[model samples]
Structure formats: structure tokens, C-alpha cells
Target: MKLEIVRSCIFGFLLVIVQYSLAQEKPNIILLYADDISARELPIYGSTVWSLPKGGDTSDRQYRAQTPVLDHLAEEGIYVKTAWAATICSPSRAMMMTGRYAHQHKWWHNSDKGKAPNKKGSWNLYDSAPYTLEDIAHKGGYATYWAGKTQMKISGFNFDEACFTPGEGSYNTPIATTDFRLETRKINGQKKIFNADTNQEATSYVQSGWYWKPHVQLLNHPKATGPLEWWPNNKAAKDTFGLNTFGPDVELEFIFDFMERKQQEKKPFFVYHTSHLGHDAMDFLNPESKSKWPGTPKISWDGKTYTRIQPNVTGDNGVYDTHGTITESGIHHHINYLDYQVWRYMNKLKEMGIANNTIFIFCADNGTSGYGKGSPVSQKGTHVPLIIYAPGMNMTKKGLQDILVNMSDMLPTIAEIASVKIPDSYEVNGESLLPFLTTDKPKHREWIYGYHKDMQIIRGDFVLKDGKNDWWDVSENPDDLISFKKIKDWRAVSEAHRKERDELNKVLPRFNLHATAHDAPKNGLEKPTPLQLIEDNK
Candidate 1:
């Protein structure tokens, strides 16, 4: 009997060891972040604005984009019903990258410099808190790769491998050396192309062509070719496949290649694909007299797959010989194309046999460009789409979760997965969402917070404290801002509503205490950073 007991104890110990080993194994994370897309734009999230016509056809132009790839992925995974992002691109990205809010990070607004009196001059938010997903993953023995659009610049964020365009240049940047750098402006009356590089500083704007002849720069790669300096070794490929080169296509190709290479080397990789889609800038819409939408290498989706036909663009530097794309303008087409790219990623993973081990997250920075990017009144400016698909984690459930998920939650989740120890001294405004990936459903945040410049918004279960200093009933919302109910007194609402409101009100002081931290006085109130009180046990 004693001998049998010893054997059973040994077996149990071995089982525990195996379980710990499996838990420690890191999974590859791929964050496919779209530009200027909102929760309302996705049909899965339910948007009547871009809903399909009664006949369910595309000719009417009102037909919503069919994102079967994302739709199916959401159906097979978990999606957050109430996901919060910052009002604009820079702050939203800062939250995601740093796992902290604007108050701590000091990225209160869009520009690179902080406008607050406490944090003044060219003091960028990222330099102070230099920790990012890249830093965490790199330290945790994982390769990190970032691609597509980077709207903001964060200091000390050096990824292991990256192919990305800096700030708003993804539209008309040249893709290859053979591609033209668009120097030819309208000389008197006629449009002309200066094939050679010119010394015109005015014509050379930071906003270069990112799509056709994409202006790109290489980082940590030897004998690499792209924006800054054209390498001699890449001249052959540039001449051959240069003219019809496309930006999105180039980024996607690099991502797939990175995945395959990682798989071959038996290494884990964290990929951040920040796509420049769902945004139709007026400048991009009418680059010239012709429609650039229906131009060049056209991407087609036949309900199942995507096919691209590279156009023979024969012209001088920036002037593409091709007129426009076959596809029309609007956010729908851009979203549809984004879906196709998602399909391509799924297939690439399957081919590499890493689909089972990969974790895919699809989200957008903010709402659509025109309607919601900088909207002040409601939570419309901050809400975004969030879908998580991780098969290796063995998640069986699909559909929406009502947990209050903040954009800052991304970093902690990644850090937890990488087995990196987030410092105990540092306080972040986010908690890990990894528990939800498993069958365990732990308690989440009671309220989420967002800051844009001096304006602050706090979201609760039934109430949304807007930047306008007004309280809103956001329950049962496809959020209509028409009805603005004023908070007269405690007797204005029912006991349950009052109870909820009181609970939410208790948290407001914590945020208000920091009102004086702004560089400039906001609404004439001096906001100071809140002091964190830690109680010690007797």
C-alpha cells in the first residue's frame, strides 16, 4: 500500500510539471489594426447607415460590405460588445501600445508634443514611458514585426523586424525604385512629370505617395530597399515589378513572409499590422482629375477569395499612366478589401501550419473618418470593433461579451501571454483579458475612461459621462444622441438608476483630482494629477 501511494504521488507531480510547461509556452500574436473604422461601420456590429438595400445588391452603393472572413471569425471567437478607444488616432494607439491612459502617458491630444503645463514643450508621451508591446515581446524571447500605417511616433520602440510607413503617407508613396517619386507639378497649364529628383522643398511634403510608388524606410535590415535610400541590389526587381507596385499588397506580403520564416525557425513572432483602410481623406479621394479608386492593380473578391490584377501603369515618376481603380470610393470598398486581406492571412497561417498556434485580433483605431473621428458629444468617438480569434487556446464559445474593454488592455494581455512581468511599481489603467480566452469569465472593469485633450469621458454600465459635462442614458443603445436628459437631482430617476448613478459618481473624484495636470488651464480649472493612496495592513 505504501509503495502504491509513492507511485501515485510521482505521477501527480509529473502531470503538474507538464501542465506548467504547456502554460509557459508562448503563442504568436497578430494584431490586425484598421484605420478610421468604427464599431458602427461593421455589419456584424449592426450599422443601419451602411446597410444593404432591400434587394441586397452593390450597385446602389448603399449596400454594406460583406466581411464573411471577419463575420465568420467573430462567430467562431469572442467579440467585445463595449470596446473603448481614444477619440483620435494618436491617443488611441498610445493607450494600446503603453497599457496606460493619456493622464499617465501624457498623449492627451493628437500632435506629437504634449499641450499641458505639467508636461510641456516637445515632451512626447512615449519617451517617458518607453515600455511598449515591442519591448515586452522582445524581452520575452519573441520576434516582433510591425507593418502598414503608423500614425504616431513612439520613442524607443525598435521591433526585431518591421516594414512600415510613417504617418499619413500610405496613400501615394512609391513602392519600388523604378516607381516615380511624383515631382512633376502643373507647369503653367499642363501636367508634367520630372523623371529626375528635384530640389523643390515645397513640393516635397511629409505626405508622400504610400500606395503606388510607396515612400518607405527600412529598419535593422542590411541590403534592404525602400524609401530613404534606393539600394543597388534591388534595382533589378524594382525595374521588373516596380511600376505597378501597391502599398497594402507589399505590407501583406512582408507579413506572410515573416510568419513563414518564423515558423521555419521555430520562433514565436508578434505582428502588428496597422492597415490604412476605412479612411477616405478628401485629398486621397481627388488626387487628380481622374479617380484613383478605380485605378491600377485592382483587387477583386468573388465571395470566397481575393484576386489582384496589377495594372500596367506606364508614366513618369508620380504620374501613374493608369486612370483609376475599378472599385468605387467610400468606406465600404476599403472595408471589403480589408476582409479579403484577412482571408489571405488565414490561408497563409493554414499553409504554414501555424493557424492552430496563432492568436488573431482584429480592431480599428476609432470610428469612420468623417462621422466619428473627433466627435465630442457622445461615446461615438471612442467606440471601436474588437474581435479575438485564438484556436490554440481551445475556446469553444462565440459571440459578444458585455465586459467593459479599454484600448489600454491590449498591452497587459500581450505581456501576460509573453510571460513578461509588468513592473509592480508602475500602475497601468488596464487588466489582462487572457482569462476570457479560456473558459473562465472573471469580473472586469466597472467603468472605462477616455481622454481627448482636456475633455474626459467615463463610461459605466448604464451611464456615459460625456465630455460636454452632461450625463447620458446609454443603455439599450444603437446610441442616438437626440435625447439629452439633465441630472436635476437624485429624485429625477428611479431607485435602481439612482443607485447606479451614485456608484458611478463615487469614481468621478478619482479622475477630477488630476484636473490641474494640464499644461494650459482647461475650462479655467487647474487640474492636478491624482495621488495614489496605498493602505498598509496592520
Candidate 2:
């Protein structure tokens, strides 16, 4: 009897351990990060800015780009309404990776390292620590994949596999739909890019042939391994998937490769697809750059459905030329392509039977350049789309979540998904979204913030105030925002509005940076000389 009792106790303890481990298992996370996109550009956001007729500004028409995939995903899950990011790329991406604001991370602007002076040298934003959301997910037992733009210059982040566009190089190869001819050579232990075309050491090729006949490098990929070059040993590979090889399409191919390879592996995966899809630099790629931008694919619409282009281009080399005239507005086609890719991602997951288990997030770094990219006076620069789609997983409230979310929240949110407890030693500013996402009544942030150069902004429910504002409320009277009388005193506004402003103002000390180099404190962060920064980065 004693022996039987002891055996039963041992089995129970073992079963408990097994169940606990299973409970702690993390869900796969895929951050579908976009480049320059704005919240106002999407139909889902209901912004009337683009509704004005086009031609006066043809670029505005592209904002009408279709995104059925994202639309459906938002309809099925949560579409964050008032999400925020930095007015620029590096700072926003840094916040997402490190889960901290500019004050904490010191990535105040988009200048090359060592050029900017403030005692903080020019290093990649997240270069300080060896850990990040990538490290967190990997350490928590997840296979990681990072593809597309590697602007952060992040050394590793512990990714099991990483493929990136070397700065921005025209991947124009002698053959192949993809001109994957870029390679990396370690010099003094630091990875340096080598261009086969130049038979010598290469310089920054950010925009030589980035879009068509493109170039890319595969690092730590599973099937397509090479010695620091592109697929199949990096030497010019044959164009198996001839012609029409859009660089963005090739970028997505890498993403699909990651998903297809890892679907059944039991171990979850994290994908940081930082696509160059949203920003407006494609005009330089147009064959006729003088008079036209690359046209959008000739697509047809039937009320609620879209018929995408199906081009028939034979032979190899310059086959991308057969893609026909780019009919879509420059950025609009890019936006439409973004939506199309999202559709593809969704369908791929559904086919693999992991769509229900995966967590897919789509958001942009900042706003469209020349539109919202660097505008400190308007929220257009900071407001971005935030969509979360986890079919089988729980969300706070589906369809539309009109919460005020910050870019800084992404890291902790990933940490929450992994069920990995952040160490006490790490001083991260963002809070985990686990409770807010899983529960209905969990209160979201009462205030949101943004920083770029010397300009800082604090926002509440009805008012958005930059450091220079005289306390005017732009969001009130949504239908007639400019109708509200200017307030001369605190008592001029409603109790609710006044209380909201006061509550938001309490967090003023949180921002410790300036709006420009001149506005900074005596020993505060300083911008590098303009000419040097622009030349160095370019």
C-alpha cells in the first residue's frame, strides 16, 4: 500500500510539471512592420484628408491604395485607432525593439553615429545591449527570423536566421529575377559588405538598384545557405522564377520561406519583416524618372473584390521590364502591394493550419514623407496604423480599439506573448499589453507622447499639444475641428477637457530632450552638423 501511494505521488508531481511547462509555452509572433505610412492614409482609419479629389496632388491619390487583407484582418481582430510612433524611422524602430522612449535610449534623431555629439556616440539605436525583443523571444524557446531592411544595424539580436537588403543596392544581376549578389566579409570582426560587381570592397549602396534587378544577402537562412552572399553561394544564380521579379515581391518570398520552413516545427517563430514598402523613394527606380513614377499593377475591381495583374513575361534578364507600365500611383501601388502581401501572409498561414495560433501585427514606422514624415506641428507625422490579428488568441475588444498606444509598447507586448518574465535589471519604459489585450476592462494609457529633434508632444483624449502650442485643442469637434474658440485660460474649457489636459501635463517631466540642436540644454543631446549627417547616411 505504501509503495503504491508513493508511486501515485511521483506521477502526480511529474504531470504537474508537464502541464505547467505547456501552460508557459509561448505563441509565435510576427511583426509585419511597414516603412513610411500614416494612420490617415488608410480607409480603415476614416480620414477625410485623401478623400479630396486628386490631380492637384497626384500623390494623394495613392493613399487610396487598397488593403483588403489588412481590412479583413482588422475586421476580424483589433484596429488600434490612435496609435503613435516617432516622427522618424530610427527612433520609432528603436522604441519597438527596446521598449523604451528617446530619453532612455538617447536615439533622439536619425543621424549617423559619432557625428552627433552629446557624449553618446553614433551607434545603432539598440547597439548598447546584447538583448532585445529578438533575444527575448529566442531565449524563451522560439526560432527567430529577420528579413528586409536592416537599418538598425543590430549586430545579431540572436536571430536564428536573418536576410537583409545591404543598405540599398540595385540588385541588378546579369541573370535571375532576384539579383541577390551582395555578400558580407568580416574585417577586424565587424561585418563589411562586398560587392561582386566591383571585385573590390564596396561602399554604401543604399539606392543603386534596390527595387528592380535587386540585390540582397542571406545570413543564417536554413535551406539557401551561402558564404555571406545571397542564395546558392551568392554568385549569380540562374533566374528560376523569371522576369516580373519585383524586389518587394522577392522580400516577401523570404518571409514565406521562413513561415513555410517553420510551420510544423513545434517551436514558435518571430518575424521582423521591416519592409521598404511605405516610403516614397521608388520614383528614382522609374525608367522614365523625369515624367512618371512606376505605375501600379493594372488591377481590376468588382465592387468588393480586386483582380490583380498576371503578367506573362518570357526569358530571363531585364524581365522586370516586361512588368508593363506602373499604373498604380507611386506610393499607392506600394501601399496596395503592402495589402496584397498581407493577404498572401494570411493565406499562407491558413494553408499551414497555423493561422489560428500565430500573432500578426501590421504597423508603420512614421508617416509618409513630404506628407507627415517630419511634421512636428501635426499629428500626421506621428500617428500610424496598428492592427493586431490573432484569430484563436484573445484580444481586448475586436474590430476597433480606440485606445492611445505608443511605439514603446511593442517590446513588452512581445515579452508578454512569450510569457518570459523581464528581468528586474532591465529598465524598460513600456508596459506589457497582455492584460489590456486579453481583458475588456483593462485601462489603456491615459496619455501618449512623441519626440523628434527638439519638438516634444503630449496628447490626451481631445487635445494634442506640441511644446510650442498655446494650449489649443485640435481634435475636439471632430466634424468641425477648427470651430472651437481658442482658450485664454484653463477655465475656458470643459471640466472633462481641463481635467484631461491637467492629467496629461503631469507626465511632462518624462520628456527630457529638446526640439532642435539649439533648444537642447547646455550638456544635452546635440544634432550633428547637417551636411555631415546627410552626406554620411546618403
Candidate 3:
């Protein structure tokens, strides 16, 4: 009896050891998604044109973004030559979260969306897709955390924890604590943006500040008093809440804290950081500046350390002094700061001794606001940078990969990484990139697709059909990253171009919902249905 008991105890101990080893093998994944940045904005893509420090037409002034850290990541890992998303933010995010296009999720554009069948509002992505990326991570035995921007409806968020996440309060009420913000109020019968500091009409930017003294909210935080609440509720955050408190910096701090806690618990994590950095916003610190995007706090990187200069700004009622602490306003400054943030992420992972066991991905939603956000011509609106690095895995692809990819691929790629098999009932348009990245796969995809409202955009290796139904020869590189040669006649093109065009032509019909009209109910479609909308011209 004693010998039999000892064998049972030894078997249990071995089982536990095996389970622990399997758990340790699962890597930590961080999805670093930037907002409103085009592929050309990154120095790695080799675009000759970039936005100036101030603001102007892309053709007027030239200023390239400084992204040494991103450049290095792309060099060491793999950067997609062409990656597409929607022409704007909402649809792009829906695509990334669901691994489906506008047709499947019913998020055709920013303003246009499918109506809910049972409710009197727009249908959310959660309603359409079987499960979200967060759900998949959970199924794969991972804790999920979301930081930075939350462009989607807050109620639909399924992540375990969130920090500096925008919420209902962001739009409903003014954060009464800080003086740096712009609010819209009913002035007589018309809604007008009022300068919170001055309580007067301000021309600079008439929206809540997301840069300096940003309006932040927290979810499931240890210090939080409720499930979801406004930040600065805690003593530490309240004390640090001032004119100098940068939102992005606070986001990183919370992420680092979460990583440390998860590490102690021996849990794999998935961090989806939707950084607001590439997007253009009003310059609140230097209100007089004509730049579209506001500047960030000055930061200097000396190879080993990054020293950020504390912002010293004092003012109210439309007048302020920055004390030469803020960098000049421009998209370039935002990109530079993002590079610094990337460095911080790497440093934290290294500190936790999880650097090699982490899968890092960087991409953006849509294109630059002024240059390409709404434009569906060529690849301007849809094209964005895609860089992936999985140091722990034996990824075969390195440096620039001349393949076509899209935002929809992110969900399935992450799902595969988490080792979660998507249910067969759900249809995901994106193909998982895990096998291609890890194995000796020669190509990722034959073509990529995108949309702008009802317009259908599809592209192959040699041919591209734009939103306007115009064809272009995209085989060769052009001086301007987007300007491909217009193909007047299919008969005149080479057999290779014709063959690829035929293949892309066949691919579009499968996704076409006859979406020329975007009214949901008019098309007799319910929530999550595959039917397309038809406009009411009456």
C-alpha cells in the first residue's frame, strides 16, 4: 500500500511539471496599432513624401518621419510591402477585430453602419462576429489587456482590463478636473466648440484633448472603485494629473504594470495597444500654431536611454506659454514619440526576461488624415505599414516582404498564435499568417481587398481596381508610392497582368453585397446577415 501511494504521488508531480512547461511555451503577444498613419509615413517604406512639422499639402512641404526603432524592427523581422485597410477608422478597426470585411461586419464607413434587428441602433461588430480577438485569447488561456484608443463603442469591449481607454464619459461630459480641453456646447440654437480654458470660441481644436491632460478612463484596475470609472480617482493618478501629464505615457506605465503582474502569475498575455499617435489633432499646448497635429513633449534618445523633457506649460483662456518644452507641432513629432514608445516596450519586455518570448506587431488604421484618409484613389487611403517580429518562433521571412496583406488578417493571425481554432460556423475572410511567417511558405496572399462605402477595391500582384472602378498597372514602383500607371485597355496589357486581373475579378464578386446603396433596412437584411443594403432614392 505504501509503494502504490508513492507511485501515484510521483505521477501527479510529473503531470504538473508537463502542464507548466506547456504553459510557458505560449508566447506573449503585443499588437501595437497606430491611428491614421499611411505606409509612406514610416521611413522603412522609402516614400519620398511625408508631412511637414507644421501642416500643409503633401506636395508643398517635405518632412520625413524619424522611426529608428520601427526601422530596426522591420529590418530584423519582416515588413509587408503592401498592406490594406479601409479608407477610414471605424471599418478598419472592425476588420482587424473580426477578420472580416465591411460586408461581413456591416461597418462600411465611419457614418454608415448596419442597423440592429432587435434594437433601435447600429449593429456592433460583437453582434456580427461569433467571437472577438479577446474571446479567442481567453479560450487559448491568455489574459487580454487593451490600452490607448478605444474607437469602438465602449460597451462592446470584451478585454479583461483596460487603461487610459476612452469611454462614454469622454463624449458625454467634460473632465472637470483639468483645464486643458475643448468642449462643444449649445450656444443659442447652434452647437459650438468652446475653449475650456478660456470658455470662449476657439479655432485651434474644438474637441476633448487626447494629447496633453487627456481625458482618461480605467477599467478593472486594481485601484478602481468600480468596473469602469474615470481615472485620477486614485491618489497617485490624481496627484500626477496636471498640465504635464501626457496620456500616452500614462498608458505605457499601466501596460508595464500589467505585464509584471501577469508575469508573476505565470500567465501569457495579449496586449492590444491602439496608440493615438499617428492621428492629427489640434495643438492645445501651442494654440497659435497652424499645424494639424499637435506636438509631443520633447524626448531625446542617446542610444541607451531616452530622456523626456517634462512639459512646462502655464496659461488659460486662449493664452499660454509652453516654455520651449514642447516639440514643434507635426505628424513627424508624433511618429518620433511613437518610436520612443516602441523602445520603451522593448525595454520592458527585456526587463521581464520575456523579450525573446514575445511576438510584436505594428500596423495602423487607414491612412494619414490630410494626405489619404478618405481618398480611395490608387492605394492612398488603404495602404498602411505592417511589421511583425516573433523572436521566439522560427519565422522564415525577414526584412521587406513584397506580398499583399490586409488588416483583416490580424484577428486570425493572433487567434492562431493563441492556439485557438475559430468555430467552423463563423466565416473569416482573412487567412492566418502564422504558417506563412513561421514556415517556408513562399507567398502570403495572391491579392488584397478594401472598400470605401459602396465602392469595391481589389488588387492583385500586377493589377489593381480602385474604388472608382479604374484599373492600374501596379507591377512597378512609382516615384510617388501611390501613383501607378493607369490601364486604359485590358487587351493592351501583358498576359500576366490579364491573368491576375481575371483572378482578382473573380475574388470581388464573392464579397460584393451590391452595396452601391448603404441603407441597412431597405435591403431586407437583419443583424449579422450577409445581405447588402439598398438606398432609398425617394
Candidate 4:
């Protein structure tokens, strides 16, 4: 009996030690999401769709535009060529944060009024029509911070800190008003900014609009208040310097600051820094030279007229300016700006002595503007860039990976990297990419699907469209620009995808019900909150 008791005690002690060790071994995650960036724009990806201006040459390889930072990251990390996201911002973000498809989130469109609702006739941030990754992180005891563009309406779940900069309606002018600076507030005698700032308030200066300097808001979180509160303009607030400060530069500064503070506390954290850099914005400083590109507008978003520049291309008609194309030089500059921001982020990590300990993930929400976003093109609007960097990882060169991955996969990937187990009750549509990252083995999905109004399925080289049941051999013509030889029968293809669609449909209940739930009240039934609906489904 004595011997048995001793053995039992030893086992119990060992169990406690192991549990404690695991609880302490969380990895820090930094997600850098660029806006409106297309796979075709990156020279590293072998595309010459756009070129740099003559005087703006920054590298010896003229064919290859400047992107030293992204190149370095690609060399140090694993580059995934087959990653995808929803075409637009809100839908893409919803899919990413919830680890579900657009059909599940019920956020197919940007506007909230069109979709289904919670029991309350309106969707509340706390209600889980879409449970966010930040919420999962918070529940798992990780501190979460959101910085930069936030287009989603739902709030709460998990975000210790949040900040947002309003996107430009038009991509013209260097200085438009923006939510760009940092303000400090006292929390328990320690100075801290509001965890999140929605850049809804208009600013006086155009540079402030650049998302880099002049105007910025700060908020404070005493505990985990559901609603974000901004710090008043008080003496305690201090303005961030904005001498030619770019938006990405301002964002990285705060990110580094947060990481260093967390490092000192020895606490693992998750930072989501969304960049508005690559998105089209007019450079007011350097007006397009008319001599090089005939009929090109000199100013982007000309404030004098409150319109975008008219491009020289046919069908442009100068009717509406979405920032006219000025020799494609503006696109190059925007990409270079994005590259500089990436360099800053990596350098900051190294500077703070947390380079190796941090797991850096870089991705975009959806495909590029012209080819993808808001369209069901052959390439699909979902395609985007995905890169992962871990100093501990043995990867040291740029590699092309054809493995199927999606925005929904990020939550699971992060969970694995942080060594946390995802709860089974929480429905997730992604598999961890940790396997591919750790092992060089090729990975492929049986079928990858993209959803908007039309659902697209990728099985081998064949793509099946959902509603129309249209079948197209996307493998032969990935761009979907080829003329059809005959009127193809879509029913056969749709039937072929029936089993996979059925599985995807099962995941749809939670989101579809949430979106349409607002109408349940008219049926004499009390509507459940989005969270309640999700919980009921579970």
C-alpha cells in the first residue's frame, strides 16, 4: 500500500509540472496584413504586369521593381502561392477572424442591413454570428491587439486594444485627412493608449489622412470593456511625430512598443497589424507628369474638384476618377511603400531582441483589384499572398508552395504555433499549415471553395460554379479569359461537387441562420442573438 501511494503521488506531481510548463510555453504571433495587394504585383512572384518610372529606379534589375523587404521575408520564410481570401474587405476579414466561409458568417456584402440578423433585429458585436479569432485568443489567455483598418461592424469577443484608420473613398492627393497618430493615457499609473481607435473622426490636415501622422486617437482598457472608449483630448495625451511619417511606419512603431512591453512581462501576445499602404491613394506631392503619359491627370483625387483622375485608357471616359493610372508608376510606389513597412517590422523585431521568439505571418485578405476583388473570375477573387517566418524555422530560401490554403486556416495555424488546442465546439474550416511549415512535404486540399453570391469549387483542375452549375476547366485556363468552344453542361459538374457542397453546407447553418435570423421575429418566434444561434447549432 505504501509503495502504491508513493507511485500515485509521483504521478500526480509529474502531471502538475507538465501542465504548468505547457501553460507557460505560449508563442507570440504577429500578423501583418496588407490591403488591396495582388499576387501579380510582386516581382518576387514573377509578374511584369506593372513597371516603375524612369527616375524612380531603385534597383539594378529594372524588370524587377523594388521590394527588398518582401524579398528578404520570402527568403527567410515560407511563401504560399495558392492561398486565398474573400474578394472584399469585410467579408474577407469575417472569414479570416471566424475561420469560416462567407456563407457561414452571413456577411456576404459590406452593408449590414441587407443580411440576416440576430434575435435583436440587429447584430451585436458580442453576439456570435461570427466568433472572432481574437475572442478565441482571449479565451485561451492571450492578449490581443488590433491596429489599422477595421471595416467590420461587430465588436467584442477579444481585443484588449484596437485602432482603425478610415480608408480613402478616392485614391487621389498625398494629404487627405486620416486617423493617424498615437495618444497616451494613464491606466493604473502606467501610460497606455486606447487599445483600439476607430478612425471615423475626420482630421484637418491632409497628411493626417495618409494614415501615418498628424491626427491619431488613443483609447484605454481598464479590464476588458466590451465597447472601446477613446481618451479625451487632455494634457496626459501626447502626439506622435509625423515628419514625413508613412502609415505603415506609424503602425510598426506601436507594434514594436507593444511587443517590447509584453516581452518585459514575459507574456505571450497576438498582434494583428493591418496595413492600408498598398491600397490606392493619390500622391499629392508628385503629380503625374503629362509629358510621359499623354492625357493622364496631374493630380490624384483632386481636392479642388473632389474627383479621381481620368485615365487615358478607353472606356475611362473621365466620368469618375478612382485615381487615374499614371503610367502604372503609382502602383509601383505603393508596393515599394509596402516593402519598406515589412522591412521596418522585421527590423523592429530584431531590435527588440524578440526576432527568433516571434512567429511572423504576412498575408492579404483577397485577390488584387483588377483581376479578383468582387468578381468570380477564373483565378477566383479569393487568391492572395501568404508568408510565414519563424526564426526557429530552418527555412532560409524562397520556395513556391502549391498546397491549398485559405484565410480560415489562419486561426488553426496560429493555434498550433502557440501550442494551444482549439475547442471542438468551435467550428473551424481550416487545417493547420504547421505541417507544411515544419516539413517540406507537399500539401494539397481535396477541394478548395470560394464564396460570394456564387460559390466556386476547385477540384483538381476543374472549377464548378454553385448556383449556375457552370463547369469550367480552370486548370487549362486559370485566368478564365478563354472563349468557350461550346455551351457546357453545368448540371453534371454541380452533381459531381454535390458531396463536397453538402459538407460545406453543413458549416453554413450557423452563419446563414444568423444572417436571416432577424426575420424569425415576424414568424412569431423570438430571435436568438448571433451567439445564441451559434451555441444552439453547436
Choose the strongest candidate by lDDT: 3
Better of 2 and 3 by lDDT: 3
Ranking by TM-score: 3, 1, 2, 4
lDDT at residue 65 of model 2 (Cα atoms): 64
The reply for model 3, stretches above 4 Å from the true place, is 1-23, 54-62, 172-175, 203-206, 514-538
lDDT by residue (236-319, candidate 1, tens digit) is 745655546666777787778787787778889999988776654312222442321222245776777778665555555234
User: How many clashing pairs does model 3 include?
Assistant: 1
Candidate 3, clashing residue pairs?
198-317
- What residue runs in model 1 are displaced by over 4 Å at the alpha carbon? 1-25, 51-63, 115-121, 166-206, 222-233, 240-243, 282-297, 312-325, 479-492, 512-515, 519-538
Tens-place lDDT per residue, model 4, 1-538, is 7667556545643443344235544557888887766665676665435323332222334434467667667766768766777666776777677777654455554554223343454333234333466755664556887777766543344577655454322122233333332234456897554311232222212222343232333323333243443222333332533223344545555566677777787777899887765554333222233211112222322222212233332221122232444324444555655665666667677777777767788888765554455655544456677878777544423466656677888877665554445556656777776655554334436555555653443333344333234444443332222222222643545454455545554543444443344232332323332332112222
Off by over 4 Å in 4: 1-24, 50-65, 112-126, 129-131, 167-215, 221-245, 281-329, 394-398, 439-441, 454-470, 476-538
Q: Residue 294 CA error for candidate 3 (Å)?
A: 0.5
Q: Write the per-residue lDDT of candidate 3 for residues 1-538, one digit (tens) a residue.
A: 7666556545643443344345546889999989999898888988777766554346433366777888889999999999999999998998988889977778888887877655567776777675677877776678899998876676776788898544445753745555566777798899887777667676644456678887778889887789888877878778878778888888898898999999999999999999999887766666666777877899987876777898988776556788999887778888889999999999899989999899999999988988889778888899999999877766767999999999999988876676666655568899888666765556779999999888889898999999999999999988668878999988888999999988888888777773553334443433332211111111
Candidate 1 accuracy as lDDT: 0.64
Error of 4 at 200 (Å): 20
Number of the top TM-score candidate: 3
